[model samples]
Target chain A: MTLFFVVTLNGLTLAALYFLAASGFSLIFGLMRTVNMAHGALLLFGGYVGWSVVDATGLWALGVMAGGLAAALAGALVQIGVLGRMQGDELRQTLASIAISIILADLMLWIWGGTTYQVRTPSWLTGGTRIEVLGIGYATVRLYLMVFALSVGVGLWLFIQKTRIGAVIRAGVDDQDMLRALGYPINRIFVLVFAMGGMLAGMAGVIAGSALSIAPGTDLQFLLSSLVVVIVGGMGSVGGAALGALLIGLAEQYGLAYAPTYAAVVTFVIMVFVLAVRPQGLLGRAEA
Target chain B: MGTEALLRLSNINLHYGSSHVLHDVSLELSDRPLGILGRNGVGKTSICNAIFGLEPITSGTIMLGDQDLSKLTPEKRAQAGLGYVPQGRRIFRSLTVEEHLRILERKGGNWTTERVYQTFPRLKERRRNLGDRLSGGEQQMLAISRALLLNPQVLVLDEPTEGLAPAIVTDVVELINQVAQEGTSVLLVEQNLHAALAAVQDVAIIVGGEVVERVTAEALENDPKMQKQHLGLEAAGA
Candidate 1:
């Protein structure tokens, strides 16, 4: 029984991280129709920046903010400097973003070296709290991560569903030309959404890196996990990303507990199964 | 130079890459609705595109009220009080009816959400439905409603009544007349000669990318010989 609770908690924590990373990726791809290969690099870059900031200031919270803001700026720069000039050519966008990822990866290696680094969790989040009902002690930071993910999920849903700009974003995804014709500056909206997506990735990077060591190739791993989440949950939907993350997270945790050697293959198996049955992913519509 | 025409096109020439689409077309619209009629592939729609700045004119001037609109983008033209409902009822399929209206609302406009709902009660009933789920007539209504929300002085409707049921066509024709009666200068393009004759005050016919005939709708409506000569359609209007 205690083992079950532990696995479930682990699953939830992993799911939260996956949701954080995948939500932004799904949103950018869904709205802009651009496959941003640099998303993974952005996550790693954000983690490294957060580590350096904490090393300098000794304040974990400030590191998190700096990481998010820095990633947001980088995201806007990528869109403006590279993707914007591609003029809606998906193939060119993919190639350009892949080139950017390579450049970012090389830059990070030169700046931070190939050695692994992790953030020091602040004192406030380091301890564990006992759950009376489950008769187990859980790390407060992991529990907080779960709560944070849930809150972000709900907050994002509300922002997209209720706000005026949210309506414009939804409309823009369907027909960009129509949105422009309505007199809204679509370029600004694109930049804002791209920045927001990057901020989410950066925040996720900080929280996840604090729990695990981040190294040079860690970007590819997280990017693969996010791709799995997006594929399973359905692209371009906040709710879809959460649900996909939860399913993949549970499968991974359970696999780790039972079939440790095959754990890495479980997510791809599930993605393949889902795709065979439903080509549009779990929650995605057939057409945009 | 005289009183400002609502939408003025002078010596307009356009090309789709190297192929010329419109040649030296000029028009002046004031208070009444103007109808541009032509056979298929005669640049009637291109004229509307020119006025809204959707397709760049190769040479000539497009003036809206007192401002030159030859270089403005589509959105800027829309902000400058030009409304367009392009062909095929180009409604956003992902947005709901209410959302479509909300996205186009301008401050101090005579048209409000409440007024739009009242004007098209069917739209109010389907306010929560996505634009794709609505029937053709409903989509057309939503398109017009979206344009009306901008409170545009000049509204260009490209084939609003096309592919609709005969019954729905009557409803759309009535709606167009109602919009023009409310003092918004309308530029209507229609293949249906009877509907055009019935709804517009003035008519212009284009042949091979130029205006070959410009006359009052009443004059053209009465002249069956002229209609047969230009449109190649026998007297269809009663």
Candidate 2:
């Protein structure tokens, strides 16, 4: 029973990280329809930046913030300097982004080398805390990460649902031409959204580094997980991303714990099932 | 007619690939509403698209007031006081009726969200419903209301009454008049001859992608011979 409880908590923590990574991916896909194949590269870059910041400044929060900002700048540049020119050409955009991801991965490897780097947590988050009710000690950083992810989820939901800019974004999702006809500078909005998606991915990278460790191939791993989560949850939906993450995360952990040999196939099976049943995704609207 | 031209298209020519779509199309809109009347496939919507910069004109210029709008993009043209309610009432399906008004609502503008709701009470009733859920009449009202929220100097409506019932058609014609009376110059494009004649003061007839004639609505109404020759319609009273 104790092992099951611990594993469930572990699944939740992992799900939180996946949510942070996939939310940005989903947002970019929802509005721009760009596959953004380089999302995992951005996450790895952010993680590396966070590690360096923490190594130099010894401030964990500052490292997280710096990592997010760096990734955001890179994301905006990608949109303006490359993706913007290929607007409306999805195949070219996807191919271009894939090339970009490869280049970014190589560049990051050259700068940071092959060594694994773990972001040093603050003293408060360094150890585990005993929960009296659960009668177990859980890693403090992982707990905080789950809470942080929850806060970000709520905040993002509010931004999309309640604010005026959010309303414009929703409208744009419905009809880009009409929104432009209403005098909106859509290109600028596209850049802003890309930056925002990058920020979330970057922050998730730092959190992932603090909780585990980041290396070169970490980018590909997170990228695959993000793709699966968004595909299962529904493209372009934040709620869908969260739900997808939770299901995938829990399934992976449970599979690893009980059926070790089949652990790798668990997430894939869920995705295949979802695609067969609902091609638009669980929460996604059918194509109009 | 003497109130100064608000929107002018001069010698405008457009071609899609090698085929020409509009040829030397010219128009002048003043204080009184101007209606472009044509049969199907006469390139009326193309003119609106050109004015909004959706399609680049092959040659000539579109002028909004004294400012040249030929070089601007669609969004920039809209910013320069050209509000368009496109054909088929292209409302955002994901956006609710209230969201449509809220996003475009400008502070200190003549058309406020409150004013729009008051003007079209049915829209207020359907405020929480998604745009696609509204009836055709309600969708048309929402489309018109959103354009008015821009407080534009000129409002261009393309087939505002298409696919609507007769009673709703009457309401749309009346709404066009009200918009014109509120000091916004109207550019109405329609195939419904009666509705166009009822709503606008001046009319430009298009045939084979060219402006055949520009005449007062009253003159066209009385001259059945010209009506049949151009519009293929009997006299208004007949």
Candidate that scores best on lDDT = 2
What are the per-residue Cα lDDT tens digits for candidate 1 across B1-238? 2334789999999999899999899998887889999888999889987887667799999999889889887778888888788788878886889888887787788999999999999999999999899999999999988888989888898888888898888888888889888888889998888878778889989998999999999898888898888888897554
Deviation of model 2 at B42, angstroms: 4.3
Per-residue lDDT of A1-288 in model 2, one digit per residue for the tens?
A: 778889898899999999999999999998889999999999999999988999999999999999999989999999999999998788899899999999999999999999999999999999999978888999999999999999999999999888888888888777777888888888888998899999999999999999988999998998999999999999888899999999998999998888999999999999999999998889888877
Docking level for model 2: medium
Q: lDDT of all the models against the reference?
A: 0.86, 0.92
The alpha-carbon deviation from the true structure for residue A270 of candidate 2, after best TM-score superposition, in angstroms, is 3.1
Give the clashing pairs for model 2: none
Local distance difference test, candidate 1: 0.86
lDDT value, residue B57 of candidate 1: 90
Candidate closest to the true structure, highest TM-score? 2
TM-score of chain A, all candidates? 0.96, 0.98
lDDT per residue for candidate 1 within A44-154, as digits (tens), equals 888889899999999998888888888888999999888988846889998999999899999999999999898888897888989999999999889988998999899
